[model samples]
Target: MSPQHRLTDLPATARAVIEDRTGPLTSVDMLSAGLNSPIAARLLLDDGTSIFVKGMRTDHRWVWTQQREADINRHTQGLAPRVLWHLTGQGWDLLGFEHIDGVHANYTPGSPHLPLVLQTMSSLAATTAPSSIDLKTMPQRMSAYVDDPRALTAFDGSTLLHTDWKPDNVLITGNRARLVDWGWASRGAAWIDPALWVIWLIASGHTPHQAETQVRAHPAWNTALVPSIDAFTRAQARMWESIARTDTPGQWTHHMHQAALTWAKHRQ
Candidate 1:
């Protein structure tokens, strides 16, 4: 991924648009480029308020994710940071969000943050997807990865799903966990989210069985069919394998690829 652009590096028009809403920035501090966004920064306004902003060139391949995050924010209410403003001009698209004062969730075994994360997931699973806009379905997203199309049915559902559960996308506050980066949100079986989390838990030091045991605390997991979970594990393993092969092969991707494989094997 390309390095994030400093706030000063924004085009004049883009800066003016942002400053108009923010009342001029007192300082611009760049934030970590979590997962997919090219530009992630925290803007401190002259009024002494701060907001987290993420942006990218208007024509960038992942530009749609910015729009998705903004569109999906309304449904995420208590689960994520609210979108403060959106700007599209001068060849850039940016979104300013209510800055969350929190730290990335720890998924390691026995971490206190795990229960908080699960609580948020259960809240999210109860949400209905916005029918006004088209959202991708998990089955469609994984179809290319699985050999038997029939297995994809296990993933289909109407529930709103934050498909990517990477720890960076989850922030642990004092008593709750707030999800971030909704670009990969999708419509899928409620249990699918817990299944996705399992791979990350394994990567975070939980044995596959231990990870599954943890997610069983989720109501959705109790309703999931064993074969369906098996199908998802298999598809996930193949999907990550493809990602590892095609996406510059980062260490994290390779690690996740292995994690998925381990989960898949444990299910067999």
Candidate 2:
């Protein structure tokens, strides 16, 4: 991954935009976590308030993600960081968010945080995707992975799906797990989000069956059709396989591919 940009590195116009909303920026602490974004930092204002900021060059390939994240945060209720403002200037697109005091969730087996993560997923599943946001459906996303495209229909739904379930994306805070990074947010089957988390569980050392049992607490997973589940598992395996074949496969991507394969084998 590329090195993230520091607030001081931003152009005068961008810094001015941030200061315009948040009284004079007094200090900046850059956060090095999060894989997709180029900027993640906490800005302390002169008024003693702190806010999180994430941004990227307007012409970057993933530039759209900044706007997508801003849009999804508006509808995420309390599941994600609240967007305070979005700005575009001096070649960068930025979003200011309410700072969250929390740590990334641990998804390993026997971790107490699992239940909270599941509960958060359940609440997120119940939310209807905002009608105004143009979201990509799961079926459309997984179409290229499945041999029988018709199987993709099983993933069709209006539920908002935070398709990325990496531990770093989930924050455990005060008896609940707060989700962040809405770049991959999609509209899909309510159960699909939990299903995505299952892969991460396996990657984090849970047996495939054990991971499935953990997610069963969600009503959507409990009542999901066997065929739909099978189809999704297979599709996920293929998706990870494709990702692992990238020019340079990261350790996590390779592990996820192995985990997806493990889950698909268990389904068989």
lDDT of 1: 0.87
Model 2, 22-42: lDDT tens per residue? Answer: 778988787777787667788
For candidate 2, the 10 contiguous residues with the lowest summed lDDT are 1-10
Question: Per-residue alpha-carbon lDDT of model 1 for 83-199, expressed as tens digits?
Answer: 988898778798999998899999999899999999999999999889975899999999988878998998999999998898989999899999998988999899999999999
The estimated TM-scores of all candidates read: 0.94, 0.94
lDDT of each candidate versus the true structure: 0.87, 0.86
- Misplaced by over 4 Å in model 2 are 1-13, 247-250
- For candidate 1, the TM-score is 0.94
RMSD of each candidate? Answer: 2.0, 2.0
